[model samples]
Target: MKKVVELRCGSVDYFGIGAINRFEGIMEQYRKRGITRAGIVTGKNSYRLSGAWDVVKPVLDKTTMEYIHFDGITPNPTVDQIDEAVNLLKDIEPQLIIGIGGGSAIDASKVVAVLLKNTGKTARDIYTGRFKPFEALPTVSINLTHGTGSEVDRYAVATIPEEYDKSGAAADCMYPEYAIDDPGLMLSLPGKEVLYTSLDALNHLVEAATTKLSSPYTVMLAKEGISLIHRWLPRALNDPADLEARYWLLYASVLGGIAIDCAVVHITHPLEHTLSAFRPELEHGFGLTILLPSVIRAIYPAAGRTLSEILKPVVPNLKGTPEEAEEAASALKDWIGGLGVTQGLSDVGFSEDDLPELLKYLRKSQGESGSLSLAPLPVTDELIIRIYRESL
Candidate 1:
């Protein structure tokens, strides 16, 4: 039997079945703050189609709070998108900001909240540190998918389409003040999204468990998260309406998010950020799935013991060696392939010719998130190229 769990991390998160009830309490707090205007950030359709808008609009109405929304959020949100959203949302002078979709939408909402509070600051200005603000407007995330833990973590990512630069930032002010994760709301996910989001959560577990700062907390959360995903992801995909499965998968995602918040995702997130930048069409989780096995092999030297322990759900008998890492990577590839995420970087329009540029942006991208430093070993140019080639 699953019970509703309320976790207080940087953000207070409500996870499990019927967790949507907590939204009223959140809005009550805003009402008491005399927050009259609310700004919403969500994708074009998922906000409505996922049944979130139907469930949330009434609460705001009861509070008699005025609200405005930017429904233009997309899969991989861009700098222009965020800058434009900030420009549009500035008219309302919102006191509260709510991000109501997956990572892309929630990440954009976090960026908008930051821009709104630090008036006249562009998304680029804050992300690049040309204008570093000490505070941001309080925000909430009504998380719709089970992948990105953006609701609970202080990190946000967006791509610069023109320069092919993807920006990721971690700051104290970026975390949502309140968040929701209701499994009932997750039933609207399509098959592809269900697989992709679950893969995203699984990769988070693997990478977070092995970072240089892997604490007992990180490893414990990651192991349980990975195990839950293994047992439940396929069930949800097979029976898309499985509330129990959705509960566990979303719970696992929360665990992964909290794990990464403490340990931080290292090499995989850095490289995947670059991959999606190279080809913006590639989904974040899709890029992670394609490169995960290669990442599993690359980090083994530094993280073998951790990998061997947490990964036992999939590769049950791993002995945690260089040879076993290869075996584990192959096994993971086969597992993910079975779920239909078999595309390599080449399949998604990346090639050897893009190598030099990918490297240049990767260097720039790594500096902000500092994910590369947390890696067990130096992710040299040669090794990066090798990982790219192997994924190809």
Candidate 2:
């Protein structure tokens, strides 16, 4: 028999609510671990919406540790932005880093933490997956948004601006030492932004469950996230101030992130990333919510049997044979389409004129991204173009 090697699982410390006034108490737990100075990273919009500055300021002020603030982090962080943050961090020189806001800020902080230690390496170097795991700066992420799970994952996604392409870096080293989930911050999120992120988390669960690398551990994460999303996402959408609904969605988001570490995203994310890079106005979650149904239809034949076997009880009308499974998967796609995210590319303002170039970029770009290879089927530039055309 061939030997199978099991990867070691790591631990995460989660602090839910009371984080605003009790942050100092949480830090006391980490203080003995040789932590000192800390840096705060957030985006301008999130800082204003969450009132994070007011909440975090007093915590830092009371601590003996020096605080450095970097507000340059942007949504869908780019390689240049990361490099710029690295340069700034060299000047600030903190031992610990706290990322406050959405996944973008947290992801940017993860890049900043690792890049600051490497000094000379570019984001591409890490993207290549060749770097040895190094001890990262002690980091904690305060999550404001309900998706992207940057709090738990070692992955940091950044766009390489010169190429107008996305790249990701993953190493166990980049996982935050602590994560705080506060529902209070989510109360201020715009209704559309909340729905966008909620859909993003839903896609994460669906894709992770269907991905080839899925295992027992990731399956549980994916299932719980999906179930919770189905249960509470609508409540959250209808009542933004419902802290209970927000908590459920937020926890579901973390579950999805943990699923990524175990099973990873396959098709929807890559296609959506391509769309977002090509058109910045299209929101990331909207991209996934739109493209996912199509991608699901494409991959159903290959993966449907396994999915049906797993989802028959949980997903209505999915059971028995491969053909049945395929039908069930298709039905699920229809249900998702009911969510109003299946709008064609044209609906989103994408013209046919953009197809050839975007398809070319996807084909060439797939060579550099591991996520593309994870698709259920072997993908080609022609295949990607066809999908785009169908989406239109």
Candidate 3:
């Protein structure tokens, strides 16, 4: 019997690898369509490194276009920051928005694009389960990192301070009108960030492939992403100058994002967001690395037979029926451990005391979180606490 599921996403045009340098060339296309003014949303670090500011300055200078820059976005952008970015957008009144940099900057850009229209409610109101922001401006993304496929998804997560929840307000409105994936920008990425973002890509693949909601298309994307990550992550790590490896990783990263768009990520991200939000000292990739093994152990047992088959390609050692797939699932943890991050919470500055607080936060957060809801087994507050304790 053929299973069925509905697949839907906002329109996005993807220009991969070397297309970044052609920003001037593409601006005419958008301009011809009346997108004269654009808001440039980028990370201070990425904008500087990718020469994005320089590339666009010439284009903006030539046209009736104007740009406003908001560089305050951080990894796992918070609700407060999105409000600020949206306020900036309202003042700029851009016809379009160009998001440059990593997932955080891109995610913030998605939020800001929509929040421009909603003067009545705050972005915080939208993020904290208070309201949903369904309207957004056209957004374009120039991706500089290989993780957090925020360029392709309508989803954007922001941590709400008052609610103490890392919820997101998602609508097709948040999806970028176009995503420019130029590996050329990735050439200058810091070694540590490259490593962490690749790890982030790997996490995205694992969660998407293993999620209960994973469909055939999502599985295919996940498998390809995992395979590419497995092959290219180390090469990029070993030869940081290898543009080929970086390019492949970037493609893999997009595949991971596509996988998530189809499958919907599970709770691991929200869980990691909880920790990352509270402890900005801890890197986002490092937090996921620490939490992944425990998360996999919790979810693997409950994943579908189709998921087990999907894993077979990425993790080729498992053979036999779906029931027997559990044996193969154990190998996933080992595979993740090999990816340059093998440490516990304590190793990353977390301790026993953090467990109770993190669990409390997780339990109180909403049900749609990619990590908790997708677990093969039903997750409870106790399970999250136990995982944290074990991770520590």
Candidate 4:
């Protein structure tokens, strides 16, 4: 049996099978500091359903930590939703915040933690980088899913439904004070939840490994994450209760999050944000998986060597040359398709007609901590259209 590992990136991560047990000590230490009031963020059912709340609630109660629970974080968290969360917590003036669930809940918590401190700032202020946050309430991220890496990173994404704007904001103040990543909490996940979240982690490694901003450290992190996901995602899917599989994937996902935190993702994430924002029902990982092949094709001229090397677990023997970009792209497409996510943009309710507005929302958020510019190749409107059309 592998022992739990404690790592400190942006937060102290207690990682392994029984990692949630660390939460008690975390709560006790925080209570010693006299920071007891907490504004908790979570998806409606996930906190309790994932078994994190059972472990956490007792700890909070034991420490006399009064908390106002906001179990309202939704998939692809919206600006309006975050604003509502801020309104709910304004009176409580929580000295600390707890985000339970996957990336969406944690990302929302990061935003709310800052908003509670910079009382006048809204989602708009942070997402657009119109104003930067210098301080935020300390945060504790109890990550339930093996994807999104929101537990350890300082980036948070929120969408504006009315404007079709989904923007990511990064700041030093947004890092959580503590994070708990226990695979035991992930056993209750449904099959599709397991599948999509694994793909989300895979895509994180994919984009982080290939982007122009990638470094040896980023590639090393992305490589291990990609290999771990390749090995464990299928096992976990076959047996949802596979604790060992869940453990590795959870570790890989944290590596993905840390890799992207150091460098960042390319066109896929930015465009997926637009797609899911345009069609609110669309899942973020499914959208990213669909765009992966097309985006890989666009980036392979520059990133082919690293991508080919990292993807060898699935792609087998391959010369990491610009010439085999199509082959690499096709292998990834088939691999993701085999896993049951065979949807294109049009299949998910996007059309060329929507492209105009999609690009509009995309351009609006560009150059504000923009990932498009960091892509291996220049991201032109023509190339962007081609990638979308190919994904469709």
- On lDDT, the leading prediction is 4
Whole-model lDDT, candidate 1? 0.84
What does candidate 4's lDDT look like per residue over 177-221, in tens digits? 888999999999889989889899998888877776777777888
Model 3 lDDT, residue 116, Cα? 73
lDDT of 2 at 83: 73
Judge candidate 2 against the unseen true structure and give its global Cα lDDT, from 0 to 1. Answer: 0.73
Q: What digit string (tens of lDDT, one per residue) describes model 2 on residues 1-392?
A: 24232222342546455555556666666566666677777887787678766767776766666777788887787777777777776776778888888888898888788877777876666654556548678778888888878788777777765565665677788888777777777889988888889889878777776676766666677667777877787788788888899888988888888777777788788777777777766788878877765676566667775455444434656544545634664566676665545567899888789988776666556323577676667767776776677678
- Residue pairs clashing in model 1 are none
Q: How far does residue 311 in candidate 1 sit from its true spot (Å)?
A: 0.4
Candidates ranked by TM-score: 4, 1, 3, 2
How do the candidates rank by lDDT, highest first? 4, 1, 3, 2
lDDT of each: 0.84, 0.73, 0.73, 0.86
Candidate 3 structure quality by residue, lDDT tens digits, 198-241: 87887787777766676777767777777787788888888888
Q: Model 3, which residues run further than 4 Å from truth?
A: 1-3, 304-315, 320-334, 367-371
Per-candidate clashes, comma-separated: 0, 0, 8, 0
The regions of model 4 sitting more than 4 angstroms off are 1-8, 367-369
lDDT of 4: 0.86
Pitting candidate 1 against candidate 4, the one with the higher lDDT is 4
| Model 2 TM | 0.90
Weakest 10 consecutive residues, lDDT, candidate 2?
Answer: 1-10
